[model samples]
Target: MSNVSYYTAEGLKKLRDELSQLKDVERPKASQAIADARDKGDLSENAEYDAAKEAQGLLEMRIAKLEETLAGARLIDESQLDTSKVLVHSTVKIKNQVNGMEMTYKLVAQSEADLKTGKISVDSPIGKGLLGKSVGDVAEIQVPNGIMKFDVLEISRD
Candidate 1:
């Protein structure tokens, strides 16, 4: 059974758009590439044909995975989200306990997480530690390196 993933409207739309692009745009391109390579003669020794076939296989696998992910995705209503504590889709501002450095991150689904944009997956160490925390609450997160402490400064819904 596929595990369900919760997404905001925008995130769900993005996933749908990506899945459509892969099927509509990329699938055809992969097929054409295979056809072009096949026309180059002897399939026994043709590296291009082999490469094209491999690429198509990889593309098909990605399409299948994306479809499965979409099938189990549920959209979360942002307006109904509680702002009193950290949860999925919550925008949280936190401060480092030792260094006093402040950072903010929006907790998102694993598929939508992008560290460069300050979006973290709920499965992440910090995100897990911050979950259910209220403002001013201290969270001790265990990372690969060591344990890190953070103070929840604020929580808001986007």
Candidate 2:
């Protein structure tokens, strides 16, 4: 059973571009590495050949996994999303009820999550807790430490 992943148009484009790079550039590089290793020495005792083979196997596995993820990727229309509740692609302003710290984050897909840019995965603890929450709603999130509370200040579609 393959899980479906939702992405914005830009996010989907990024994924497609990455897949293209892996297929066009990295694939050939792996093949070349194997060829170079094969020409180096005897088949039985060559460490370089074994290393190259292992590297190629890992590369192929990554490609296969990316392909699978791409197959189930679905593009989400930003304009169609409801801004009343927190959801994927929704820019939410939340206040930590514990320490009075306010933070804003845009909920994105797993692949597009970048904490540095304030884009968080919807599968994350805070994101999951914020899902379907509206303005003025208090959400109790379970973190590794303990349960933390957050107050939803606003929700908007970016």
Give per-candidate clash totals.
0, 0
Model 1 lDDT per residue over 1-158, tens place: 89898999899999999999999999999999999999999999999999999999999999999989988999998888889999999999999999999999999999999999999999999989999999989999999989999999999986
TM-score of 2: 0.97
Off by over 4 Å in 2: none
TM-score of each: 0.97, 0.97
**Model 1: runs farther than 4 Å from truth?**
none
Give the TM-score comparing model 1 with the true structure, all chains together: 0.97
lDDT (0-100) at residue 6 of candidate 1?
Answer: 91
lDDT of 2 by residue, 1-158 (tens): 67788998898898889889988999899899889989987979999899989988998898888888888899998888888888889999999988999999999888899999999999999999999999999999999999999999999986
lDDT of 2 at 100: 99
